[model samples]
Target: MKKTLGIIGGMGPEASEVFYLKLTQATKAEKDQDHLNILLWSHADIPDRTASIEAGKTEELWAIMAKDVQMLKDCGCDYLAVPCNTSHVFQDRFNTMMGGHFISMIDEAAACAKTVGTTIGVLGTDGTRMNDLYGKALRRNGCTCVYPDKEDQEGVMHIIYDQIKKGQRGDLSLFLNICSHMKAKGCDAVILACTELSVLKNNYAELSDPWYLDAMDALVKTCVTTCGGIYQGNL
Candidate 1:
């Protein structure tokens, strides 16, 4: 029996759409029915994760996400995927609420990074950086995680919010410059830990450099595998 995959998305709607498209493109489907069953809840109204985290008031945020989890469960989803990286800071709470049905995007990315190299760079929002979501997971899997310097990190935020999230084409030069900075810091690979960055991965052809592992891609692969579907590779 094939399982159903649930998505708790719309932390930003664009990233959620990317995740869905990747799933469709990755599945080895010759017919419509061959694709895996998916239940998506695109709730764009969830409070800003970075702002909530920075303010030290995540209780309301947690409540909103927990409600989403319950809705997925009620909808008969077998496993859950959240596209937003910063939202994984509530993994423990989600585990408790969902009883281990959540599939972690960070864990999947860390596993992939472990195969490629020992040192990796992480690029994401202030909330994801301050929480060390990728850093802790990669380190636990025996890899060293590097972060952008203060200036570059701010630039990362600008690329995600000011450009990609606003539906503008991101500055490829800015994105590559940060990747080059990570390479200069001795990182063998970089994880695009933000879903908004994942949007960049889908939209920009320039990201084909192979040095970046996108969190959304990781989640798509996991969703396919968990639902007992074969991944035909990115389309």
Candidate 2:
């Protein structure tokens, strides 16, 4: 039996699109309806996760995302997923709204990172960093989380929110530099906790000895499993 996949998206419109496309390819169904049943709410008006985190605007952001989740629930979605890593800020809020069983990219990524090794570096927006969503999940799974320096994290935020999420892609040198530093810091792996990092994966041939974990890839894999789809990714 096939299940419907409801997406709480538009945190960054590009990641929402990427999630849809990846889910389609993963499902491998010929026709549109044959593909995974997806209900997407691409509400670009949702407040920025980075800004909300840095400026302590959590209530405003979650309120917007909560409405989206409720709409998906009202639409009769069987399960809910948010493609944005930072939007997981509202996990607790969504849990309270949806009864506490939402599929989480943070947990999925943490489990995947454990398979790769125990110590990992996290690259995400300010909200994700400040809130320690990924870091907390990693700790729960017997993994240690290393963070980029303050300036490096700021750089990552700019690249993701200011650049890639807006569909402008260039200047990956800073990201590469961070990867090198993580590897040097003895990280066994690194989780790209921001879904927008999906656009930056092809720039290098494996930046370091430490494995690279893409949170978007983890979400796609979850979708594949829930919808009986085929997933092809080495992360």
Candidate 3:
């Protein structure tokens, strides 16, 4: 039997939608009722995660996220996940407060990367990048971490916020250039640490695997297996 899943989302509404659709695609189901019961709070009004981290509004972000957790709890979910990678800077605190399991997409991504290569490159928002969130996690998993240079970092932010978040197809070359930079730097594998980038990955079937891993897909597989459901993996 599959346990109920809770999604604390809306860090960017587009990312939340991608997460749900992928979750559905990743699940093994024969009937409409076979899907895990998911309680999604796609609250678009929550403070922007990157902005909150940059502006020192951690408390405001936490308070609002806490309400989302409580609301999910009220819905009786057994496992919880937040689709936004940038928002995971507070994952440790959330794990403590969660009534059940709070799956860490960051950790899952790192683990997935470790299996793919010895040196991994991560791409995410400034909040996540500056904090070295994936860096710490990837190191712990016994993989070396590589990151985009300053100009490439700005390009990453642009693809996420200026394009994908705006529901635009986001400049593919912008992302590919960042990837090329990582590969040039000896990155054997690259993680799309941002959910918005996962959107790009989903749209572009040409992005080869093992060379690239989607953190959102890791979350989907983990959520499925952790909740006692079979995963129909696309990874």
Query: In order, what is each prediction's RMSD in angstroms?
Result: 1.3, 2.3, 1.2
Give the best candidate by lDDT. 1
What global local distance difference test value does model 1 have? 0.88
Judging by TM-score, tell me the better candidate of 1 and 2.
Answer: 1
What lDDT score goes with residue 86 in model 1? 95
Q: How many pairs of residues in model 1 come into backbone collision?
A: 0
Cα lDDT, model 3, residue 232: 93
Q: Order of candidates by TM-score, top first?
A: 1, 3, 2
Q: Estimate each model's TM-score.
A: 0.97, 0.90, 0.96
Q: With candidate 1 superimposed using the best TM-score fit, by how many Å does residue 54's alpha carbon deviate from the native?
A: 0.5
Mark the regions of model 3 whose C-alpha exceeds 4 Å error after superposition.
none
Candidate 3 structure quality by residue, lDDT tens digits, 1-235? 7788989888778888989998888889999776778898888898888899999999899998988888888889877899999889889877887853899999999988888788999898999997899999999999998889999999999999898888898888778878898999999888899999988787777774658788998999999888877789865
- lDDT by residue (145-168, candidate 1, tens digit) is 999999999999999989987888
Give the C-alpha miss distance for residue 201 in model 1, angstroms: 1.5
Worst 10 residues of 3 by lDDT: 202-211
lDDT values for all models: 0.88, 0.79, 0.87
Candidate 2 lDDT by residue in tens digits, 58-142: 8887777777888888898877888888888777777677676478888898988999888899998877888899889999999
